[model samples]
Target: MSTTLHIVLAAALISIGGCGDDTTPTDTGIADTGAADSSPTDTGPTDSGSGDTGDAMVPYVPDWSCLGSVTTGTPTAATADVTATFTDFGASGPAVGASIQYCPWDDIPCASPTDTGTTDSMGMVTLTVPTDPDPYWGFVVVELTETRRHEYYTSVPVVNDATPSALILNDAAINVIALVLAETQDYDANGVIGLGALDCAGRVASGMRIELTTGAGTAFYATEDGTFSTSLTETSTAGAWGVLNAVPGDFTATAFLGADSTPIGTINFRVKAGEVAGLFMFPTPDGAAYTP
Candidate 1:
């Protein structure tokens, strides 16, 4: 692959602004970027059609294969403090008295809680979970009667980090997500894909565009406020990106400036019809821009 690699598409161990206000979380250690360019960026999302790369408009074909995956929540611990916050999307507020549980990533309808807690006045609960050398894929299970459904499940990438785990609240803004639901809506188990572009330091990004490798007409984008856009001219922000009604399966996507075909890099991930997946976007390590 002679093309310079700029961005890294990783399974958001800490998906979509996963970490809350903590600015100094360690590097998450994303790697294999080829001489990342120190350029200015405005990250965006991908959807159904290809942007004009100024070429012959041949269908976009991803030149890169799947690379190794990166998991954060590092400096593994035997036990860690995992904090989960429950929010009320309709009212734009936090909840009180919500319940939570922990389960291994492979478990569904979790057999039982690995650890448990109840949200306090602030809707936050800290659970002590044992950690391992590798990050835990699925942990915190949130239970709240305020939403359309009584349960919300997520993978806490910050589970292994010494610091408190990232906030596992609902996407709250973006809709059509397989897993993200609002207080006013019914839970839909249909498939959808979303991305939260950010810097290695955990800052959200905007202005870049994401494209599906399949050209399957599944592209979609949204802003921080949760509105959706399918126009080729709109750029996706750290706010949101993905296929609203996606074709479920393993998929590949490339990141680039809005409407331009030059890729920052390619990301690989799987999306089942009924789960929420957030893809993390990173620019070169020099802080080219953000998700900084």
Candidate 2:
């Protein structure tokens, strides 16, 4: 008995032949010779119409979406529970362990974030907003990958339940810090008397009345309790005060003594979302003016 081993490079074929029991060779179309057969029909990988080039090209498509239940109030509560679920485009599994952030829609320099957290094992996060006020339009950001891919969800509206108002995009919250002294004196002799009345420690004004209205004099903060509740007269306690929500633009603030209806000082200023504007009210020898 004789055995022959044949190796061919052109068609990448190997064959074995022997004169034993007349077994048919597995390498089809190859003669029972041990020489390399480099034929025209046996072209290598680049052979035309050979159908062995490679896998077909598939274009890359992004996978992203926000999944979960999100709700907003007419006048959003001071605090509310918010839940978010992140998933890939197919919505099959969670985008696990991603970073998430909630930015107030009205925040100027929109890059500034209001709240931040990370996704859980199930690609979900529950948030308890600490400073949520009425008209809470903002953005929710998800960092999808380690390569810095980002997804931004915008125009989320939230408002206080009691004094419900529609959320306005690009608007801001204004905090008015009032310094009320018992006397009509400059309190401090600085020419800028408003900055001089800085006795917020012991002389913190508890019931100083304040009002914020549109440039057209339409009062927006008319509630008595003064905490975004429209039914209460908004007042100050210990100099920390605020107009919970307002459109981003020009507006006027009026200050009065505790429980006094008379407007002692008034100032007009522009407000921006997620920003603080400071003003000082002093009832002094001069009639009424707000400095700073």
Candidate 3:
């Protein structure tokens, strides 16, 4: 009976083993499936100088120091192309192979859809601007031949048709020289230097005047006083009388305080393009003009 019982139990165990499912275990580390991965690692290109890698950064160089402009001497119409002449101060002649981009003046980071061009032998480029009832324009020029980045700013007017070249009328060359003349008067006897109606040395003065004379002075904005006299204001709020567009040459500056009969000082100063010359006038002890 015992032997028979043992045989039956062994048979039941064998039957249970045969009924079990046979399947292989899976790996949890790396998935192995029939479908392909939709999101793979990206190995795409990036912009230059983005510092993607943890390496030492390269220094940047400037492409241009200064630039100029040229227009058709007319207001730019919406359908017309606005032309400009760009020259570099560092270069002796025209800037060859330079690129020009037209953007809105308020644009902080100039974006795409930019009208672009390369400078020809004359360093001139034409940009097509869209027509609008009201338009304010800005420009950027890049010298691709040089490794460094450089840009300049100037006004671009948009009109219905080509009128006259008025763009960059006030945007003179950065290196162009200028002159600043200051008048000082001491109202109180305290001897504290201040720009006032009276000379610090206690001299009574009447109407004050400043004159800058040069042949090229007329080319820029000159006063109606026969080019010898410039626009003048009596208030000391202006700080100084200015000759902003003085050409490179000898110039005579005269200042008078008190009455027209009284002259403050007449001094000669030489100016170079792209530089600034300063002149100061004070009353002499004998009521004459002196420059210090």
Candidate 4:
């Protein structure tokens, strides 16, 4: 009986040991879900150089405003007076001696125009329109200026369509066409001789007077229609010799046509001493004075 009991006890102990060996503990410690979340991962906020972590931002703004006359009008054809005034929005106005530019609209390239004038003491600029009439178009641009240092410009337009009238004079009053005196022939004994003639369009008044003043201070008057010749000679008279001896200067010849000695036409001539001079008259109307 004792031996049987020992065997059973030994068998029971062996069975327990086998069961423990079949079911061993895993030793996993903790489940591996992902990497550790150290330092909060920093995903919420980013470094944008300004340290501005907020999502909102401010916008940018511009500095200048356009100021000038933008009105349109019809300007006078002969003379269109336009003016502009510039005032400083800032503390001080433009520096003294600073220049301004003005331009018209029809001008090509519209970059620069011939009609530019300077500013006055009061920072005001004035420009005159072209003497001739221009066709109807958009605004005329006037550019006010500053140099490259600080470039500033303004534009103004003058609008109008009425053309100015031209000056008119009576045609009958314009009788004499031209007056001329030329160096035709020079003589060693006579010094210098010049022929004088009057160019008339219509009938010249009878008893008209023609006066010729030579460069050498020699002067003569003629009442006839054809031609008159005079010579510069050394004389004893004070004004006479002084004029004849001096070098030839500019000569101004005048013609009085009407009975009251009204000036019909006056012409200019360049005379040189010791040279023969010639003068021609064109009785045709609207004849131009020429030098040969």
Query: TM-scores, in order shown?
Result: 0.54, 0.27, 0.30, 0.23
For model 4, the run of ten residues with the poorest summed lDDT:
21-30
lDDT of 2 at 290: 22
Q: Residue 182 in candidate 4 has what lDDT?
A: 39
Expressed as tens digits, the lDDT of each residue in 186-290 for candidate 1 is 225444455554433334445566667653424555433334446544343323465545555656666665545444435554555545444555443232221
lDDT of 3 by residue, 173-221 (tens): 2112122122221112111011111122211122445555441332111
Model 1: which ten-residue window has the lowest total lDDT? 1-10
lDDT of each structure? 0.41, 0.29, 0.30, 0.24
Give the candidate number with the greatest TM-score. 1
Error of 3 at 90 (Å): 2.5
Which residues of candidate 1, in runs, are more than 4 Å off? 1-23, 27-76, 149-156, 159-194, 207-218, 223-227, 232-235, 246-292
User: On residues 171-245, what C-alpha lDDT tens digit does candidate 2 reach at each position?
Assistant: 101111111111121212211001000011111233445565453211222111222222335332212233323
94 Cα displacement, candidate 4 (Å):
75
CA RMSD for every model?
11.8, 34.9, 37.1, 50.0
Which sequence of candidate numbers ranks them by lDDT, best first?
A: 1, 3, 2, 4
User: How many residue pairs clash (N, CA or C atoms closer than 3 angstroms) in each of the candidate models, in the order given?
Assistant: 19, 20, 23, 17
